[model samples]
Target: MNAPLLEVQQVSRSFGDVRALDGVSLTIAENEFFALLGPSGCGKTTLLRSIAGFEHPDGGAVLLGGSDLLALPPNKRPVNLMFQSYALFPHLSVAANIGYGLKREKLPKAEIAQRVDEVLETVGLTAMAKRRPAQLSGGQRQRVALARAIVKRPRLLLLDEPLSALDRKVRAEMQLELKRLQHEVGITFVVVTHDQEEAMSMADRIAVLAGGRVQQVATPLELYRNPANLFVADFIGTSNLLPGPSAGQHLVVRPEDVRLVAPGAGRLDGTVADTQFQGGTSTVAVDVPGQAKPFLVTEHGATEAVRGTPVGLAWQHEVAVGEGLA
Candidate 1:
């Protein structure tokens, strides 16, 4: 709708013989929180870098707000990148770091100070304005980095694994903070991350990439519940991949969807191979006859079966079947 705020058309990149990105294309609407998610080396970072003008694509165009970004330098484009490392000037105070971009633009001192103060308050770091990077905690440092990026009032913000360095609890807090900041500022945020949970919890839409190609793009729930292909189903979360003939090919089903019934109650019988207790949930591995690998079943109820117990396994036909890939 409204002509996407950012359009990436047939983007491709290569280094020597290795193709890092292959004919990838996507559109990001204004004020959308878009995430590029995949395993390491899947080209998510390359795509973000291409948008930020750090990496030039071998083929394709990156357009921002209908303007060709390829024709401009990184600074010339209305984009700011908040690097993963925080990239704070350790030597500069919090205010100084936040005002770094404004200083480079040669804005008047009063204006730079006013904008810096506003952003510091917006990120809730006004109390630590005099502190340097070394004086702040991990979360504070992250906010400083964010304030620095948003101070320039760019049309788009690029984040490259911005929360990967923080501890789990702090990372979770920052996720909500980032979302709130985005809503308050109303700027488009495109983040590149390999952490599935991070992307699932934060993004409005996720683009799953594999081997330099985009596998699927959808809302978090849509991607999780109705994956387009096998790679996406396995990557987004824990699942049981059962190998069976379907239209002369293989099919998969989720572990939670597979039910364990009394022996002789279902079509298949399996011996309980192992059990793992994870607080409130349990995962039971069942070894079925004629199958090389065990089938994993995740149940929320307390453990009822012990190892070596014979059980019947069944799944709804709809859950057991996945669309066959070509």
Candidate 2:
């Protein structure tokens, strides 16, 4: 097998009382879009910072292409970090801001300009090259930051909550844009994000972290279908965990998997407590007598379920077994 482009071997970090990263280890392939996903204070950011040389690990080593990345200073490392804020200079034009790093390197002005223009076109910001940060939209500014990072041609690009600054619509747009840019630049992108959907939409592989430990590392579909443990099943998406046939066993079922049937027709029966219309789909909350929480069912298109209506909840038993969850 080819060696991984980036290897984080048993990396750990602590902040006085708290262990921010506890023996976390993972690898990223060349030109891969990777994501470190977790809730706030879950060490995803800490791990990202460690890779970018902002934080030194207390143990283990970080390797980039078989070389020790920890031994190099932040600037000396072949990596660029894009902050959530985009950090574009308000006074500098988009072209100038994108070329700032090259200028600092004392590269010839023509070379810097050529690289800046190429990256601007790559990011679809060539038309806005003359505009200052203040004149650009939030999404445009994010593009500027991305263009600046890629203009340096770093081996690895680290993004800290890259889409958190945009509004919902813009965030959605940028999610696809990010994936496109990663492919276009062919750079290994390691993004740290608390948003599960964002990671699912953008990452080629996702490392779900919790309590300073990596819970699971898999593709979005694999992680969603075959969660390594209960935490992963619960965290990745909405799962209806029900009592299994055996003692002390539970089966994880997705809302979409739960089918509504006639009375006495399925494994469980419940009463519809509420129905939520969500554009293309609807969520029906069913109150099963024995279950502590209401069981949710996702239905395609519009659904009408009057409150207190009796409903039967059924799902394919083999689905759980197929996923190795049973």
Which is the leading candidate under lDDT? Answer: 2
Clashing pairs in 2: none
Q: After superposition, how far is residue 319 of candidate 1 from its true place, in Å?
A: 3.0
Write down the TM-score for model 2: 0.96
Q: What is the C-alpha lDDT of each candidate?
A: 0.89, 0.91
Off by over 4 Å in 1: 1-3, 244-248
Which residue segments of model 2 deviate by more than 4 Å?
1-3, 245-248, 321-326
Q: Deviation in angstroms for 25 in model 2?
A: 0.9
- Model 1: weakest 10-residue lDDT segment is 242-251
Which candidate wins on TM-score?
A: 2
Q: How displaced is residue 78 in candidate 2, in Å?
A: 0.4
Q: TM-score of each candidate?
A: 0.92, 0.96
